[model samples]
Target chain A: MIGRLNHVAIAVPDLDEGIRLYRDVLGAHVSEPQDEPDHGVRVVFVELPNTKIELLYPLGENSPIRSFLEKNTAGGIHHVCYEVEDILAARDRLIAQGARILGTGEPKNGAHGKPVLFLHPKDFNGTLVELEQI
Target chain B: MIGRLNHVAIAVPDLDEGIRLYRDVLGAHVSEPQDEPDHGVRVVFVELPNTKIELLYPLGENSPIRSFLEKNTAGGIHHVCYEVEDILAARDRLIAQGARILGTGEPKNGAHGKPVLFLHPKDFNGTLVELEQI
Candidate 1:
């Protein structure tokens, strides 16, 4: 079952601008951008009192969010990550409920080095969901 | 200026189906549907451990999210609400920084009965940001 609202990922066309918007303009505590080539993203963490806002930009040519950025252009909310206990069990439950898992239907090393899986946006009110193991 | 992430608003095409996805499928604590006819929205709150996910659907003929739902079809992240200490001060600062605020540049009563202001998506990395006075 979903626990905490881990983070809301926003895909920005420009990472520096995204950082400035959240850091300088909004005055939130923001982390420096870190490139995660494995995940094909350059991410910055905007820490809030209750949760985090992840600013993501495509890293490589075939970055996972490249097409998303292309369609969104300026930027957009990429996905919402929720914390879950026993991700494998959660995946099975989601499957039993006829929910679709994205990718190869296996958990992968997420941006936080935690096991994470993507759920189809169509099955989630058109909102892309990421379930991260706590 | 931005504090806790108050909530993430998702504009869903179907309110009951949205509730079922979060409550029945995802197993999150869900609230009963509350119709804010004044705001032209029917809302359901998914209470997460850290924050809340607001499931929004059009309530009246001229619902604000009606156009958004038309574009998104299945539903999508409508906006991210952030808590602010002093909304007027935040508005002035945002204006000074060349940011555009939606509406008549005055804070209005939000769904939570707090003064809130919406920023233009174009100036916010394509993210519609709502700043609610806490």
Candidate 2:
């Protein structure tokens, strides 16, 4: 089921550079970037009504974003996240319907400190998608 | 500047099947799908605030969506389209900032019959983005 458009995730090679680009060009206010050591990512948020623009940069060598960058020739968009009312319910429904879960069983804190889960790209047609519950 | 998120474009193998899945599961209202012969696409829009979820299916062999589908092994998300007040101004700015334009020079009618242009993925990093003017 389609829910609210959560946040659009953009993978950038350099977090600070990307932040400056968006802020200066788009006049978007950049939130403090958070480093998620567990996820191997550093993210900054530009909040909007019912949505956000998430700037993601790899935090470590093993970061999945790094691999995505390597394989993906362009990096303007990484994923489209949808916000669901219930994370667990959404996850179960998606999995039952042939979607593959990429993250662990539990929902992890995302950039906005909301519970989040990522679906495998293979499961979503070709797009890497994330689901978030505030 | 980034106007509003006009719509999120998702490339699907089958438009009818995708519409059913989104409507039945997500409770989204499916708008009358439009066929753009020039673009070789049939698109159905599910509207929301400042955004729409666009389900795109190829209309012919030369369809760019078809090539995207072929190159992309997965089938989930495609590109994120942002709304801009002035398509021409935005296009010029992006080009001045080293971003490449993908579509024809002139703005063409998009799914919603709005003026639209596509920026090369190389400009923003790796995300394929579309800009629409309402």
Off by over 4 Å in 2: A48-50, B48-50
Model 2 DockQ (Cα-based): 0.50
Tens digit of per-residue lDDT, candidate 2, span B32-131 = 8888888888989876544678888889778878888787544556787777789898878777776677857678887667898887766566667788
Q: Show model 1 residue runs off by greater than 4 Å.
A: none
Q: In model 1 chain A, which range of ten residues has the least summed lDDT?
A: A15-24
Residue-wise C-alpha lDDT for candidate 1, range A1-134, written one tens digit per residue? 89999999999999989999998899999998898999999999999999999999999998999999889999999999999999999999999999999999999998899999999999999999999998
Docking class for model 2 is medium
lDDT of 1 by residue, B1-134 (tens): 89999999999998889999999999999999998998999999999988999999999899999999999999999999999999999999999998999999999999889999999999998999999999
| Candidate that scores best on lDDT | 1
Model 1 is docked with a DockQ of: 0.91
